[model samples]
Target: MAHIETPTDEEDITDPVEAKKVLRKVDWRIIPLLQFLYMLTFLDRVNIGNARLWNLERDLKMSGYDYNVVVLIFYVPYIILELPSNYFFNRIEPRKFMGVIVMGWGLTVTFSGFSTSFGGLLVGRIFIGIFEAGMFPGCMYLISGWYRRHELVTRMAFFFVANDIAGTISGLLGAGLGSLDGARGYSGWRWIFFIEGAVTCIAAVLAWFYVPPFPENSNFLTPAEKKWLLNRLKSDNKGMSHEKMTIRKVADSLKDWKVLTSGVLYLAVCTTAYAISVFQPTILRTFGWDDLKSNLLSAPPRLASGIVSVLIGIWSDRIQRRGVFCLGGFSLSMLGLFLIAFLKGSLRYMGIYFAAIGIYIVQPLCIAWCANQVTSSAKRGTITAFAGTLGQFGGIISALVFPSKDGPQYLPGIMTCVAFQIAGVIAAINLWVCLSYENRQREAGKRDHLRELSQEEQDQLGEKHPDFRYTV
Candidate 1:
């Protein structure tokens, strides 16, 4: 056996076989754990809604306003802490940082089972919001460190499908847990938190080993493989990896136009996604079904969403156009909302499938799209975190929009979502125009250059490198 020399940018290996081999290893060792953790994370977050169907509000004597308030409180810390949490993840040990946060949230959910009053549930939700805030942005930052810009949307789709899968199964799990209402002197809803929370804790323990840190710090990769991986990424993105967090880098990320516009786009889409996540069960119940039946039927739309997200991701990757799909996906979402809003009977019910597809599928693309614009490792963390933080504002709007008075048709909420979906479409168009103009500028600058910079210099310049192009 011979050691392969560390590749320079000019000599970077882009062999399909080698790329596939490494990707497969990463998929096997990394993606599954992240997916599972996210599944649990999502399951914990939404199961409270299911618990409401099982008399959660009644059990605690929670007024409609109180219930909404409790739900709203969670997003407070979720919005405030996201950027700082992600920064901590970037600076700290991934396994420990991620594992502790996972465990912390799981414990929070577990204690939620014991809540005897509205105040208790509020306490549980607040802490759950605090710890779970880090999960998506942190995991995303980690995934970006591994894949090239073109490859990111698919990987993000793979990872985000967990939310859809969790949505699909969380209903079934809730229904099944409902059967345990009297089990061991605990209510079924209580059992849901206890059992799901415990599973999350177990996943956290496994994550400590399975969720390897940055590739450079991984124990699994050989020196040759690390060199090849880093160089290939460097060739695709000059500042893809090998950077530490610093104050100047953080400030630069905040000042970037791409970061501001991308965050706005993400916030728009997230408003739609968060609304769907919380209200789907209640919305499905309007189809004249019982609780169990509503839970069961809700599964199909999410399953469709999971399937559509992956397929759309593959298509987006192949086309190498993120903003186009974002625009298309959000446009589809608006149509779905219109169908659900104005149509009657089965047609409106059918709209769930379209709505689910539109909302869930666009999520991965939004995250990947913002991430692709920032090439520096530290800036990636800051921008992704900032975008995620802003998106939490959508969650706040989602909570308030679906007031209890708007039962069955819920026209106001539906219309509000339609409006936001339209906003999301507009945001997508803006992102496309911005990226297109910037990429043209970069291309033009390259043509006017007097001399080519060395690979090292280009790598140091990152997304600002004259040869680097943004993924639109």
Candidate 2:
């Protein structure tokens, strides 16, 4: 495999104006396409929640616990395939690999509408899980490759905003399509699957043309701009090394304490996020709103959360701090969970907005934070995928927590989410303290003995190099 070589002759882009201009150009070309792809991915994944609102369970003859079983089935392959899919993603051309997976899931989603029984739906979800597994982590890895550490959280936040957009659109689309329940003799929920899936298929086709390759292979930038971008990223990690995917690197990533801790944080956040995406409409319906109103009302919280995410991304980047922001976000989420679990009427509804904002805020930040601490491409990709795989367990937990028997105010489910949020807070604090201690040790020259190693050995050390400081 080829590596991105930094040009020896090229100087850094010293002018702030030119730097901003180059970054803006890159952002416009890539961010929108990435956002669109992720939006579709999310839309297809969670629209099942909206589908339930339109008599999908009744029409398919699903009985007690059957609906949750279908939801749980999607996460099985999704979690299992994440590591290998991302491994191939690291090895393959970005455009080809991403396009194929998007198309695969899109077709699966479309055909999913044809299911006549719970077993059929279950099968379709498994395939969807397999295909969709690579997307979010792959995108995070790709974004990390493009931007420097300080610029990363904001870009990732913008990318993650796609989730909020998809959630909002899913709600609106569910209501609009639900109105077409009898059109062409197909149920409205079926139309949701058919139409959204078809759009994703089309987007997948466009991805082949529009998706930017990794920086080394990208043709859209000038030679100078590309060199500057690559060099900028190189400087961000000082002793960082580029390496091909290898089994050892994968094992190293799995063994890293930082990776394990980050995965635990992500798992906590994902548990809350998956629960909300899959059950928000149902929870809202329990608030005395009819199906249409439940779907419609779901949109606002997502929109509000999207705005908050972008703002926090900018602030987090400005301060160049991740852990503190994450702690604050977790606090907000816990507050929201408390209100929803214990309060009544509109106050409980207000909890949705709080939970949405905090969860969305923490999620992208956590990914960015993890990526920030890793300096090797291979290790970074593996770490991202491994953490994401652990996070998907949250989807399984979500499926089990909100049984149909626990409606109106699913106290048990809401409280479970609250517990996860508190766990996230503790994890964040532990990671922050540990990294801060490590950084202080490096400053005190405790790691100076490793500086005697050869340059090649030092480079291979990646984040463990004496000069390579951990981001707190």
**RMSD of each predicted structure:** 3.4, 4.1
Show pairs that collide, candidate 2: none
Worst 10 residues of 1 by lDDT: 3-12
Q: Give the runs in model 1 whose Cα sits over 4 Å from its true position.
A: 1-18, 239-241, 445-460
Candidate 2 regions with alpha-carbon error over 4 angstroms: 1-14
On TM-score, the candidate that comes out on top is 2
lDDT tens readout by residue for model 1, 69-101: 877899899988988887788888888887898
Residues 312-363 of candidate 2 have per-residue lDDT tens digits of: 9999999989999999899898889888988989999899999999999999
Best of the candidates, lDDT: 2
Compared with the true structure, model 1 gives a TM-score of 0.93
Error of 2 at 39 (Å): 0.8
